[model samples]
Target: MSSSTELTEKKVFLLKSLDGVIFEVEESVAVQLEVIRELIEGDCARPFISLYNVTSEILALVIEYCKHHAETCSGGTSATIADEDLKTFDNEFMNVDENILLELCSAADYLDIKSLFELTCRTLASLIKDRTIIEVRKMFNVENDFSVVEEKAVRKEFAWAFK
Candidate 1:
């Protein structure tokens, strides 16, 4: 409990992504992910929380989001970063390609980062909205893996919704 010892134990944690990349993250940023927060609260947080399902690229993006949010919400930067500014940041953060967006969505879900998950989902939904099935597939670079007949049948089943 010495002041020097307390100062040495900085409020930070570590996360290892699926690609074996290790990230040193502040506790404020780490808490943005519900799963990480749970681990900390349960006293089960290790020196490094291994995210076996998240890639380094997506994890980096998630960390950036958490860091920004953590700083803004801590009231330390609210005077400079308002909620509207956060919304703008979220909008721009989701402007990546479909593949990256998909990865972000999956990572957000795995990390239980609610805001990020919702933002990615909304970005995905908006991409498909008011677009034809073919356009939607093209936008997502989705190959028709299904056989021709199967594709026709499934498309027919939900034909009304598409129209």
Candidate 2:
């Protein structure tokens, strides 16, 4: 059951992504996006807030995440996502391709969603942690940019990292 405050605060905001797609989100969800929270607070979001940096696909995912978090944190049961636990939902949410995960991380940073940013960063760290330099370079498809001597110097400078 929703509290009287929750029921009374039924204002909806429209968020327009870079792809020209718009999403309607409730106040609860909107506050979670720190980048737009000022607009909501100042009543500037009466018109749709344009997210110039985030694409529609990523924006949708952010909204979904915020909604789920809001529902769960408010002690309200969310019937969405099969009523999955947040940890399970977060695991599934981060199961996208590496490219998509990078995009999501970038979007989360741009949108200033702290939880989403941390989750994405943690997921990415897990993937890269304990991997060798060559393996990581291969994973990111990054060609070696350093000459042999420069590489040796840098490796020697951070010798502990090489170990």
Candidate 3:
């Protein structure tokens, strides 16, 4: 029942990152973030969405990812694209340094991008799999809070699994 003009109208949203950088993104892309979708659904008239905890660098990466997902799932001929292509895109999307990956993970979690959050977490887990706690601590710059005795006790308990 809507007129063609209404259907043809585009919806864009302005998002402000932690560093005061603003990005103009399409509604389709914004909706991919559950937090943003809730905000938009709650008030479509709201012009600006602010992500206070997300740095501009991480926010930019998230925006790029959401836009790619939105376009890939746009429900047209491209919707029938091969799954392998999507996998390739995902692989390439996750190719980044550890710091950027961690930042992206935090951004994804804050934005409630389930797919992105899971992907980033999985990528991080992969990096730590089979590595020693010392290596993990070094990689993530985590301080060893456990004393030598506690560390040895826990390691002794899990010695069977460490083989």
Q: By TM-score, who's the top model here?
A: 3
Ranked candidates, highest lDDT first? 2, 3, 1
Query: Relative to the true structure, how large is the alpha-carbon lDDT of every model?
Result: 0.85, 0.89, 0.85
How do the residues 7-77 of candidate 2 rate in per-residue lDDT, one tens digit apiece?
77788999999999999999999999898899999999967999999889888888889998887777655
Each model's Cα RMSD: 3.4, 4.8, 2.4
State the lDDT of candidate 1 residue by residue for 1-163, as single tens digits: 5688887785778899999999999888888888778888786877689999998888999999989887677665555556877888888888898889988988889889998999999989988778886787887778879999998899899889766
List of clashing residue pairs for candidate 1: none
Count the clashes in each prediction. Answer: 0, 0, 0
Tell me the lDDT of model 1 at 78. Answer: 54
TM-scores for all candidates: the values are 0.79, 0.81, 0.89
Candidate 3: what lDDT? Answer: 0.85
lDDT of 1: 0.85
Clashes of 2: 0
* Structural RMSD, model 1: 3.4
